[model samples]
Every structure is written in structure tokens, then in C-alpha cells.
Target: MAGTGPQVARSPLELLNNQAAAEPPLLVKHAGPVIFSVVGFIAAAGANWATRRPLLSGVHRYVLIVGGSMAAGIYVEKKRAEHLATRDAMFRHYIELHPEDFPPYERKQFKDLFQEWIPIR
Candidate 1:
């Protein structure tokens, strides 16, 4: 007797293509942090070399310090932005899936919590 089971007949070429698509590209998946790390290392080495020279006066040193601090602040702010965006996306998804959990009034309160200003007039 022949087997009478539902079969998914996929061509070999189709399966290979599917697998290739499933695996992320090497550079796209892994090169980001590596490239950033290399660039950061190079920048740090250059900064160290520049600061070691006596040609940099007090003002130059101070400016470099302040500039490096600001760059750190900017990087932190960018990470914060990315985090907030992800959080907001998750919150939105949750709200969409379980709308009963967040009523209009509660939604307004949540929005107010993140708002820059609350009008009190």
C-alpha cells in the first residue's frame, strides 16, 4: 500500500535558495561592531599620538578633552534614542495585540509621561 500522507514537495533548488536567504550575509550580520571597533581603536591611537606631542598647548588639550566628552555624550544620546524607539515599538505592538489592557485614558497618561511639557493653564 502506498503512503497516504500530506507531502510538501519542495524542489532542491528552492530549498537551497531558501536556506541561502535564511542565513544572513556575513558582512551585514557581523561586520558592524567589528568595523566600529577597528575605527574606534584607530581614533584612540591617533588621539593618543596627537596628545603626546608638546606642540599641543593647554587650550588644545582642553579643547580635545571637551570635544571627546561631547562625542561620548552624542553616542550615549544616540543609543538612548535607539532604546526608546525599540521600547516604543514593543509598547505599540503590545497595545495593538491587547488593546483592552490600555484604555484611552491610560494611553493619554502614558503619552504625558514622555511628553516634554504638560500645559497647566
Candidate 2:
């Protein structure tokens, strides 16, 4: 039964725990937000300056930008994973309802076909 299903893709943690998969680097994973981050940097800098906040505007901008990027990246990845997991589960159900509908023609369980996959928006 080890290879009977679609491979669940091994992540570092998955590999360690023997479960599901790996993830892209934060920069790569959250690249989409780079623009937003730039905008936010501008905004944070503005706020810092307008309020004359104790923190330096430049430092504040970088901190907010970096922190926001990392947070957004992690959040996006988590949501993506959850979405993928849900889709996979649905696929699994479909496989159950009509196994013949999928390929490999001889796959037993529904987890196989998934050695790895690219996440999409």
C-alpha cells in the first residue's frame, strides 16, 4: 500500500515525520506581495514621518515591510495548502465514487498521483 496511492509529496517536515511535502522559500512563495509590500513601505514611512514616531522612518519601513512580507507569505502558504488539501480530499472522494474516471487505470487508493505539485492562485 506504500505506493498504491498518489504520492503525498514529501516536505522536509513531512519527510521527517513521513507525511506530505516541502514548500518554496519565503521570497519565492510570497513574491506576489512584493508590490504590496513596497506600497506598504511607502505608507509606513509616511505614517512614521507624519506622526513623528520615535522609530526612524527608514527603519520602520523596512521592519513593517519585512514583517508583513513574511507574515503574508506564511499566511498565503497556509491558505494555499489548506485549499490544496481540501481539493485533494474532494478528488479522493471523486476517486472513490468513480475510480475509473481517473487514470493509471489500476491505482488503488486516491492519494497517488501527487508526488508534488505547484500551487496556484
Candidate 3:
């Protein structure tokens, strides 16, 4: 919760903390092929006692390609979502506290500012 009452303002720290709580856990749980590929590459070099050349080489390529893409995609999506949510929250807070400060052009500017805050998906 940010704050109580209609006139109360949410502090920046409070907003951030509330946002953090509302957001999903930061970890990328399923790393796809990336994990297996890196491990396989290391193993292929015979660094581990259990290393097997054929298995390592066979899996390495697929894991590197598929898993790396999946992981990168997930990361980008999470970042974009966080940015948009923060922008939306800030915009709402501004409008609530300063309803009379905006002209039509300033409203457009706010919309533009919100869009600018997030990277294009």
C-alpha cells in the first residue's frame, strides 16, 4: 500500500517499493538451452571427469541458439513491462495531484512522455 486518504501523496520510495512488490519475481526460472550449452561446452573441453565429447558437442549448438534467444526475449519483455508500469503509475500520480495544471497540449505531452519512457515492443 502506498498511502491513505484522497489527498495523501505517495513518496517515490513508497511507489518504488509498491511497484517492486506488484512485479513478478526477477529470476528467469527456465533458461532453456543456454544452461545446457554452456555446461556442454565446458564439458567438451574435458574440464570435468564426466565429460563426454559426443554428447557435449551434440547438445551445445542447439542449447546455445534456442536457449539464448528465449532467455534474451524473456529479459526484454520483463524490462519493457516494468518500464510501462512505472510510467503509468507516475502519470496517474501526476494527474491526481495536479488536475488543473494541464492544458490539451500538456496532456498530449504527458501521453508522449509516457510512450517515451518505455522502449518499443
Candidate 4:
């Protein structure tokens, strides 16, 4: 004999864990920020030491500003790439699940538009 029971709803933690398992990890996610932060700090510290002044003074200020800007740009680009990848994956899955919703012409158009982000299969 076997017992039968209704399915139980997943808790928030379980859902999060499942989602994390399903999604592909982005290498740039943590690498970009950590690398940028370390580089910026080192540059600032070196500039301050060489000039014997605070980071806000002279060349040190410029170095810190440039490093910060570069870091921000890298982070933004990485996030954008991740977002685009996720969107493209969802779009492909949706197309597979509901082929009727997308006509051949429209599918081709979408594929062409995202050719850079998504590889044609």
C-alpha cells in the first residue's frame, strides 16, 4: 500500500534555491566588482603615499576619479550583459512553449535582432 497526499507549496527559501540551481552563474557578477574595487583602492593608496597628501588633492584625486568611473562602467556593462542573456533565454523558452504565438517571420525577426546575444540553433 502507498500513501497519497496533496502537493505542498514550496517555501521562499526552497524557491530561491531552485532558481539559483537553474540559472547559469555569471562570472562577471562578482569578479568585476572585486577586481575594480581592489584596483581602485590600490591606485588611490599609491597616489596618496607618493604625494604625501589626501586622496582629494592634485593627481591623487584624478586617479581615484578615473578608477571609480572605470569600475562603474565595468559593473554596468556586466549587469547589462547578464540581463540580456536572461531575457534572451526566456524569449527562447517562451517560443518553444508557445510556437503558435510566434509566426515564422516574427521568429526570424527576433532571432536576427538578438543574433549577437543569442546563438542560432
**How many clashes does the backbone of model 1 have?**
0
Highest lDDT scorer: 2
TM-scores of all models? 0.39, 0.42, 0.36, 0.40
Q: Which ten residues in a row have the lowest lDDT in candidate 4?
A: 9-18
lDDT tens digits by residue: candidate 4, 1-121: 3545432323322322233443446764456665666676677768777878875567656666567856786877778879977876776676667767654432235666664666679
TM-score of 2: 0.42
- Per-residue lDDT, model 3, residue 62, is 51
Best candidate (score: TM-score): 2
Q: Residue 44 error for model 4, in Å?
A: 14
True lDDT of residue 34, candidate 4: 59
User: Every model's Cα RMSD, please?
Assistant: 18.5, 12.9, 14.3, 14.4
Give the runs in model 2 whose Cα sits over 4 Å from its true position. 1-57, 103-121
Q: Give the TM-score of candidate 1.
A: 0.39
lDDT (0-100) at residue 95 of candidate 4?
A: 65
What TM-score does structure 3 among the candidates reach? 0.36
Model 1, 25-116: lDDT tens digits are: 87655444445555655555567667794343455554555566556655765787699778766765666677665544322357667758
User: How well is each residue in 79-100 modelled by candidate 3, as lDDT tens digits?
Assistant: 7779988887887678667757
> What local lDDT score does residue 101 receive in model 1, on the 0 to 100 scale?
59
Better of 2 and 4 by lDDT: 2
> What is the per-residue lDDT of model 2 for residues 16-101, given as tens digits with 9 covering 90 to 100?
23243457797776675665566666767777778887545478567867679757766776788799878777666666677455
